[model samples]
Target chain A: SQTIHQWPATLVQPVGSPLSLECTVEGTSNPNLYWYRQAAGRGLQLLFYSVGIGQISSEVPQNLSASRPQDRQFILSSKKLLLSDSGFYLCAWNGGTANTEAFFGQGTRLTVV
Target chain B: AQSVSQHNHHVILSEAASLELGCNYSYGGTVNLFWYVQYPGQHLQLLLKYFSGDPLVKGIKGFEAEFIKSKFSFNLRKPSVQWSDTAEYFCAVSSSGNTPLVFGKGTRLSVIA
Candidate 1:
C-alpha cells in the first residue's frame, strides 16, 4: 500500500521567517505530488503540483514554492512567511496514469505569529 | 483551468438520515471527479471518484456519488449516515489524468445519534 508522510505536525514561526514543509511518498514511483491549503470555509486551495523531478506547476501566486527533488520527495518552501500564510497545509499524491483519487498526508498546522 | 463548487458549508444530521451534498464543476472538456473525506484528526481519504462511464460511483462506508455531466454536477449521497460520518467532505476536479486537481469549499458534516 502507498502512504504519504508530512511533517512537522504543527509549526509556530515568527513573521518573515523561512518556512519549509516536507512530504514523502512510499510504495509508488513517478507519482503526482500536490500541495494544498485548507481553510475554514474556503476548502482546499491548490498551491503547487509536480509531475516529475524539477517540474512544478503552481496554481496560486503567493509566498510559497514547491520543489520535487526526487521522485517521491516533495518540499514546500518559502523564503519569508507572512501572517496570511498560516493555515493547514496538506500534502497529497496520486498515480497519474490512472486518474485515481489522491492520498493525503496528515496535514501540518502552520501558525505564523 | 477547472474550478469546483460545494455549496454546503455545514450540515447536521441524525444517524440513519439520508445525505446529499452538492458538487458542481466548471469545465467543458473531459474531466475527472472525486470526493474525499477527512476525519477529525486524520488525513483525507478517497470516498469515491468518477472518471468515465457509469455515472453512479460507489465508495467506502456506504458512500456514493452520481456524476451528471449535463448539469456539470457530481453529488455525494449516502443511504444512511452514521456518527462516524461526521467529517469534512471535499469535491475535486481535474482536467486530465496528469493535471492538478481543483478543490471546492468543503462541506462539514456532523452526524448525531
Candidate 2:
C-alpha cells in the first residue's frame, strides 16, 4: 500500500522567517504530488502540483512555492513567512493517471506569529 | 477555471439523522467529483469519488454520493449518521484526470450523540 509522510507535524515560527515542509511518498513511483492549505474554518486551497520532477504547476499566487526534487519527494518552501501563511498544510499523492483518488498525509499545522 | 460550492458551512444533527450535503461545481466540460472527510486532528481521507460509469458512488462508513451531471451537482447522503461521523466534509472537482482539484468551502458536520 502507498503512504504519504509529512514532516514537522506542528510548527511555530516567527513572522518573516524562512519555512520548509517536506512530503514523501512510498510504494509508488512517478506519482502526482500536490500542496494544499486549509485555513481555519475554510476549505482547502491548492497551492502547487507536480506531474514530474522539476515540473510544477501553481494554482494560486502566494508567498509559498513547491518543488519536486525526486520522483516521490516534494517540498513546500517560503523565503519569508507571513501571518496569513499560517494554516494546515497538507501533502497529497495520486497515481499518475488522471481522475484517480488522492491520498493525504498527516498535514502540518503551521503557526506564524 | 473550475470552482466548487458547498451549500452548508456547518451542520448539527443528532445521531441516526439523515444527512444530505449539497455540492455544486461550475464547469462545462467533463469533470470528476470527489468527497473527502477530515476527522478532527487527522488528515483528509477520500470518502468517495465519481469519474465515469456509475453516477451513484458508495463509500466507507455508510456514506454515499450521487453525481447529477445535468445539475452539475454531487450531493453526499447518509440514511443514518453516527456520532463518529462528525467531521469536516469537502467536495472537490477536476476538469480532467490529471488536473489539480478545486475544492469547495467545506461543510462541518457535527453529529451529537
Candidate 3:
C-alpha cells in the first residue's frame, strides 16, 4: 500500500521567517508529486508539481519553491514567509498516467504570525 | 485560464436532509472532475471522481455526482446526509492527462444534529 507522509503537523512562525515542509511517499516508485495550499475557507491551491527529481513546474506565482531530492521525497521551501502564506499545505501524488487518481497526504497547517 | 466554480459557499442542513452541491468548470477540452471533502482539523480526502464513460459516478460515504457535459457541470448529491457530514467540500478539474488540478473556492457544509 502506498502512503504519503508530511512532517510538522502544525507550525507557528513569525512573518518573514524561513519556512520548510517535507513530504515523502512510501511503497511507490517514480510517481508524480504535487504541492497544494488551502487558504482558510477556500479550496486547495496548486503551488508546485514535479515529474521527477530536479524537474518542477509551478502553478501559481509566489515566494514558494519545491524540490524533489529523492525518488519519493519532496520539499517545499520559502525564503521569507508572509501572512498570506498561512494555510493548510497538502502533498499529493499520482501514477503519472492518463486520468489516474491522485492521492493526498495528511497536510501541514502553517500559521504566519 | 482553466478554473472551477462551486455554486454554494456555505450551507446549513439538518441530519437526514438531501445534499446537493453544484460544481462547474470552464475549459473547452476533455477534463477530469473530482470532489473532495475536508473534515474539521483534517486533510482533504477524495470523495469521488469522474473521468469518462459513465456520467453518474458513486463515491465513498454514499455520495454520488452526475456530469452534464452540455452544462459543463458536475453536481454532487447525497440522498440523506448525516451529522457527521459537516465539513468543507471542494470541486476540482484537470484539463489534460498528467496535468495539475484546478480547484474551486469550496462549499462549507454544516449538517446539524
Candidate 1 segments exceeding 4 Å error: none
Q: What is the lDDT of candidate 2?
A: 0.92
Docking class of 2: medium
lDDT of each prediction vs. the true structure?
Answer: 0.93, 0.92, 0.90
Summarize candidate 2's per-residue lDDT along A62-88 as a digit string, tens digits. 999999989999999999999999899
Proportion of native contacts in model 3? 0.59
Q: After superposition, how far is residue A58 of candidate 3 from its true place, in Å?
A: 1.2
Clashing pairs in 2: A98-B97, A99-B97
Query: Ranking under lDDT, best-scoring first?
Result: 1, 2, 3
List runs of model 2 lying over 4 Å from the truth.
none
lDDT by residue for model 1 (A1-112), tens: 8989999999999999999999999999999999999999999999999999999999999999999999999999999999999999999998876478788899999999
Q: lDDT tens digits, residues A1-113, model 3?
A: 99999988899999999999999999999898999988866778889998888989998899899999998999999999999888989999887763767889988889999
TM-score of each: 0.96, 0.96, 0.94
**Fraction of the reference Cα-Cα interface contacts (below 8 Å) that each candidate reproduces:** 0.78, 0.75, 0.59
